[model samples]
Target chain A: MLHSVALKTLHDQRRSLVGWVVAVVLLVLMYAAIWPSIRDQPSMSDFLDQMPEAFRSLFATAGADMSTPVGYIQIELMSFMGPTLLILYAVGQGSSAVAGEEDRHTLDLLLGSPVSRARVVLEKAGAMVLGTLGLAVATGAALVLVGRLFDLSLPAGRTAAAMLHLALLGLVFGALALAVGAATGSPGRSRGVAAAVAVLAYLVNGLGGLVDWLRPFQRLSPFYQYAAHDPLRAGVSWPAVVVAVLTVAVLVAAAVWGFGRRDVRG
Target chain B: MSSAPVERDDAIRAEAVIETHGLSKSFGHAVALRDLDLTLARGEVFGYLGPNGAGKTTTLRLLMGLLRPTRGSARVCGYDVWHESTSVRRHVGFLPGEPALYPTLTGLQHVDYLSHLRGADPYPRALVLAERLDLDLDTPSRDLSKGNRQKLAVVLALMPQTRVLVLDEPTSGLDPLAQQELHTLMREHVDGGGTVLLSSHVLGEVQRVADRVGLLRKGRLVAVDRLDALRARSLHHVHATFDAPVPVAAFAGIDGVRELSVVDHTLTCAAPEASLDRIVKALGQFPLRDLTCTEAELEETFLAYYGRGEDDAA
Candidate 1:
């Protein structure tokens, strides 16, 4: 397990982890606080209804009632802002795990010990999972707190389920970044590749519903499984959860294999 | 060559701790290390001397299992470096030329973390080494000076108490006093039956502690022999200024003098140690005003090996 490496890596990232958690919590609270004002405006629903269907679907806000607390939270937090923040945090942490060590010329020192290469990669991936999970839990707690204070009557179980899905979604990108880092000992290239994948996947999922040719390929996108089911309203989808977990597992395995085979650059 | 006995007999009797057979490494089309054959006995401090980019670092990295060799093989403690790297690493302690530490970690934290990874208790040894090197354990590594960071790296590499120590340019950033202290520590380590493979471009540092040295040039092993023997064969450049003009033929018949030249009142030539007495006697007959003899630098000695071809190498 290389417990010491994972623990030390987590310890090193504590400051950045705390900063990200605070940002996610504050963003969730601010959006939840304004939900009452939007619900109070009666004509806001008519305004949203009159808007173009293509525009609403493009943002993954279609079939969501803006006046309701759950609908507003899904669009503002879970669908867009929350995932964006978590993905950024996850990708940054994952890419830096291996490639950053090489960049700083510290990988040789670590590998000089008796630890196996596979253990090092696996332990770093474990640290990334723990960090993203912390962010997700903090975001869920902040939503629950704001919901009670504002009397939005948010469902606690469903919100927790949404946070779990969000965390898994972040894990997929984190593992992808880690895989890229292991393949090439370049942090900038790893981050660029993972970020590009995320952006392209999001676009395909967003525009899939309107374009006929893209609709068939939407299921291939992780974002489609992430937002298409609306876990906040209908609870967790087992198939989607399976796909997310499988993606994380496959990417992490690839990272370990790639790292074990390559030469460690000094 | 001097026939004085080497100080340690245990080193001669000990089994080979490190051995390489036709070891070669190339990056793309550029060869970093050529087909090299070498061996180091247990409890011996073997100095690896070479110029920059002369395959010193490449050889160390190959032994550490950080880079795979393109041909042949290297072994540590009788285990192949690439096939049984974990076992090799368990027995070896290494200090890289450029030591990189975690910026957020303090020196003490780094020690603890690395110690934990090695699955050993190094706290006691670490504290003692830190004091010897005059390093602040509480300072963040990023905030420490280069010499301090080097001190920290030395502490980490030495604290593990492994069987073999591979140090590459270990004294690079250390002050003179600290370097002296490190030399004392290395001698003690070898005395206590630990094998050391030290690679450095600094010739004097290696000459002080090494029992024998292997000279490398252009990725090839040019020479390997006892330090005293190599020193005996080294040539010195002699420049003598006389009160009157002297004939170049006066130095021609000296036992080990060569390339003798006379320009006006000055005479210059290369002389080996064995011919020093004859040359001094010959110079005394003339009116000598000023005389200076400079011992050949390590680089010059290395060039001398090439000048005479591989047959003349000890």
Candidate 2:
């Protein structure tokens, strides 16, 4: 029954999902194809060293010391491509969960059914997780292909873990979006709030990585818990996973409880 | 048409499909419904009559578990509207005043989605209703006209195999032929021992399908009686044109007569019932040119309650 609901949601949103998937795939291919040629330049090491910490924080860690043939792949894929993919999925899924229903005026229709309001939110969120998971798998395969063609020695376990980490991060954002969607009950306002929150978190996470004062504020952002390179390539952060899980749980619970009691007349 | 009288108590029996006790709902300073007590017996086609903003839609929404009441309570098939909303929702088929359906989906998809939510595949009934109503299943809702949208809503509400129906202005957008079809459909449902609470502004529609009518003014039910009884209570306006000026004094002291006016050579009398024999006999002495009589419409009686300032502000 749960799967049926999720599948219904997917079929309802199949057009939009297909469009996003194609766009993401093309984007990944373009970046992956263009990135291999930039790895061979002699000035690459000096350029990596000269790069500002803030700029480095925006994408991934780039440095002369880590400038091996494989390091080029690490700096580009882990820092830049991975987080961008994660954020895109997060924003897309999060805004669509509640706001999409409001847009279609199906929220009232859905609520009018035998299903509980909590189940609607959870089911849509679950569908988003599945979609993001699919995207992650596609991105991982594309990354592996790019690595092989470019002669970049990418660790299979670490790369797969990174993709999984990104997928989980997307879910966190998606759940937060769901909460916003449920609370506001307007697609435009919910999407705006979710975007603002996601962008703010990303900024805080970036600044914390670059500056010392903002480091303390880093704990507040969900991104701080998702250190892409360290997790997949080096080691896993159990604390970060716990914190992410807790954040998702609290937001979703609050959303469901709030929605359950709300007068869903609209 | 006279048959055995149905007891008022049994008109709404214990096997009632819907019951509300003092169900009051208010939006901030505006009172939508106040002390609303309603009961719909099994197999009865009930009409809920009220003007715009008379809390008709609000009442239906509350019954469907779409809106929670501010005070008091209601039960659908013995299931609490607020506490056990899911159970209540499962058994009730609701047609909102303006059903905001998914515009992109075809008529078939609309039925499929609604049935899917109810945890039942309502394809057979949906197809039957669509064919009966002449709704094109292949066409998307946006492509359909207002009447078709209403048809889709009706199909969605009726397709579900539920005993109780809470329909609000179900036939508002349909054409005359479609309206006739809907009336036939509703009667069939009632004959099959299904209950329906149809809220509508059109009295003729209600009179045709509803055995009992509940007249609502503002947020309160002013009259709840048999449709025929309610009609019998309304005044009939009779006008008589004489060849010469006629004295209105002869029609005096009549039981049902409320106001009598004579202008030029015409005598106009507004009364609960036209005393045709007395009126004609009295006019025998005079040269009566023309006589026309019109019974008060149910809407007029409804307006009379409201027009007299009976909670018009509500």
Candidate 3:
């Protein structure tokens, strides 16, 4: 039954998926076609090093080897692109699942069926999970092709782990959006709030990376927990994985509880 | 003051349906329901009648477990709305006054999504209902007109084989033909032993199908009676066209008879039930060519019950 709902969500959002796919293709081409020629440029890190440490830390991983092919991918794409795109897609998709129902006046119709509020919450979450997975898979495939073409001997598992981290982080963002949607009565307000939360997550995590005192505060932003540098250079951090899993579960549970208590009269 | 209690009056009972007792609700200062009592029998076609703000929609919302009542309580299909909301939701089918559907979704996709939420296959019944209602499956709900949106709401409401149906203004945007089709489906469902609590403004439609009617005004139930009883309590006017004019004096002595008149070889009189037979017997000797009797029906009686009178303001 849940699979059916997920499929329906996909079909309903096919237009959005198409747009994202086109954007992803263009992004992959830029990394594959444009970035490779500049990998050997000695002046790249010299130019980046001139920027303030705070700004530099926010954009690229510290100690990253910009002279190599795989390191260049990390510096150019995974540092900024991974979290930003996932955050955008997660907020846009997840907030609408519930709030969009209110906007369309279909909440009454859905509630009137033999459907429980909890089940609705679960189905919407399932759709977001699948969507996040699909995105990770697409990005992983693009990275694989680019890695081979550039003759970069990067291990497949590391990039795979980074994509997994991206997807899991997207799931967490999606859950936060779902909770916002459930609490606010108005869809437009919920979307606005969700977007603001996403931006805050990015800003805190980004700024915390460069500043000495703010480094401790970065844990508050989900983006800090999902930094691909550790997983991309070393391996998946089980502790970070645990945090992501726990936070996603907690947010989704709160969303279900809130939905259960309130009146869905639309 | 006592009359024979109607033998066929069976108290409604439902094993898995929504029920409310003395349910009352208010928004800030506006009272929505006041000590309202109702019983929806299993598989019974119950018609709810009320003017605007008469608490009909509020009652349905409570049954759907959508809103918490300020006072009193409701149960759905033997499930407590407060304690067993999930169970209550699983058995009840509801249609709101103006259904707001997802504009981006096609009719098929919307049904599928809702069905998925219910943990069931959503499209088969949706397909059948669309066919029955003559709705195009390809059109997005946003593009559908108001009437078409209403039709989609109907499809959603009736597609589920729920034990209880709580429909508010179910026919507002329907054309006459669709209305008739809906009536037929409702009657068929009731005949198959499914229950319905239909709220509507059309009196004639209610009269044609309602076993009993509850009159609500300003969030209070002023009258509850069987349709026939309401009509019977009011005065009836009889118009009899005879072969020849009968003398008015012939019916003057009858009790509870008034306005006896004979003109153009026809006789007419206004009387209650007791005097009706006597008046007819008095003119038995005359050849009766045409007789047309008109009763003060439930509609007029209902209007008069709520009619504004001089004393009402005072």
Candidate 4:
């Protein structure tokens, strides 16, 4: 069938992909447009320093600076907004992969083909991965390209590393959504599970710095791997990337395994 | 001439394309299907008849491996429906009741994608089916009429010419003209040594092409017989207007009488072949003003068997 499932999935997502890309470009431009003004204000750095320690630890990464381009992007985009956009897109695709089809009563038509269940799950997951990665590249290109126009320059290698970690963070939750969707053919419920777990993981990673008891489990959170080492500053962390990649791989395998064993909702 | 019928019967028995052994499915305590042991052979159309929610859809989905059985097993083309579903699907074409299609895709795109998924180019066959069914291949499914959508579903399912056709209420949204065309297609499918399992609550939908019929009720198969055999015992509507008011007791104990009522001077009821003479005799005892005896709809005959009760077919 020439990877028909994957190709068809991507074809179905063409419009949504464009919308997400355009949103990314516009968002990057807005941030880049504001970088010049923020850099010109020396008093902005004092305002951040005077903020409560808990607020700084939760929202601002280590070595917070309002004047520097990398720190500004890290505190503003990398800390929250970037991951939110990517995770939303990934979770959307993930939910629609299997459970959303079932919810729409189209799973029967798709599975009516001679393809195996494992192949369907794997191909849909592949399509989601490709869509997420493509969006990540667009975001990176937009950040670098848009940054130049506003006199805000960022290190190329570190920006790429940040984009890589952000993509992995998105993939982790996307795969989780896919696994939950495959196990239970309920789109709303699967998305809810993924979003709730993501919020909890974000809280654990962010609040872990100030909350003593949460420290041991903070590394287990995907957000920690995404930003605890701050890829925008120190560049890529091989160990964190491996952990994020492995989490996605395991979740995809679980999707195949769960889907193979259950009865597909008609 | 007698040997011809025997050879056809032998041909049917020679190939059991669809066989189920004590297949059962349940969603918790609510049993959707129970111990379904049905066999469909090549060169025949078996009409699976039932009212809505009679587990007709459940059986069809099970045969397609869309729903796994809670107990027992089924095989299509000698392939296990659940364990070897991919192999089973390669040989079967299924049209679910109210078949869903991608809202944005055109009929041709569906044909292209589904046929490609089957790993075969059935585009030519699909084009011919679409033409014969008078379906617009360029219209998006969401924009098409219900009848047109159903026609597209038929085109997609029938394109492959698979060994077995599992159709659920295939004619629900079709016009009489399209229904006739679909029936003809089904006949041709069997004539070419393929098997068709056609499910419908209305017996007329499948009677024109079905050689045999199976009635399902509350997830249980209540009756399975040749279409003609069921027709032989088919219920007949007996309506009579008497000159005088007739008591209900006059026809209280006649066998096979259903929907029986003697309201004042009018007596209206249905009875099968065996009870017709008794009903006629009972009418004679009263001075009859008018009498009308006609064959009931095939569905009425079927309902006379299992349609009465608190209908919770789901």
**TM per model?**
0.91, 0.89, 0.80, 0.90
Q: List the residue pairs that clash in candidate 4.
A: B53-B313
The best candidate by TM-score is: 1
Backbone clash tally (model 2): 2
- CA lDDT of every candidate: 0.85, 0.74, 0.73, 0.89
Tens digits of per-residue lDDT for model 2 on A1-266? 21245777777667776776677667656655655566556576677667777876765542323445346555665665666667666656666677677666666666667777778777776777778788777777766765567565567776677677677677677777778777766656665776677778778887786688888897888776776336555656677777877877888886777667756654
Error of 3 at A161 (Å): 1.8
lDDT of candidate 1 at residue A199, scale 0 to 100 = 89
TM-score between candidate 1 and the true structure: 0.91
Compute the lDDT of residue A170 as modeled in candidate 2: 71
Q: How would you encode candidate 3's per-residue C-alpha lDDT over B161-269 as one tens digit per residue?
A: 6656778888899988877777877887778777888887677778777777777666666666776776565556778887876777777888767567888778877
Docking verdict class for candidate 1: medium
* Docking outcome class, model 4: medium
User: Candidate 2's residue-wise lDDT over B1-314, tens digit each?
Assistant: 11222234433434878889999888888888888898888888899998888888888878877677899999888778988887777777778777777777888887777777776664589899889998898898899999999998888888875777778898999999889998888888888888889999888999899989888878887778777776666767788888988676877756656568888898887766445556667768788888887878877765553346675455
Q: What is the interface RMSD of each candidate, in Å?
A: 1.9, 2.7, 2.8, 1.8
CAPRI band of model 3?
acceptable
List candidate 2 segments past 4 Å from native: A1-3, A62-85, A209-213, B1-14, B140-143, B243-249, B263-265, B274-287, B305-307, B311-313
* All candidates: TM-score of chain A: 0.95, 0.86, 0.90, 0.97
Candidate 4, RMSD to the unseen true structure: 5.5
Task: Give per-residue CA lDDT, model 4, range B1-314, as digits (tens).
Answer: 01101123333443788999999999889999999999988899999988798899999999888888999999887778999898778777889887899999999899989988887664589999999999999999999999999999999899988878999999988999999999999999999999999998886776788999998888988778898888888989899999889999989899878899889999999889889999999999999999999998887787678566636644
Which model scores highest in DockQ?
4
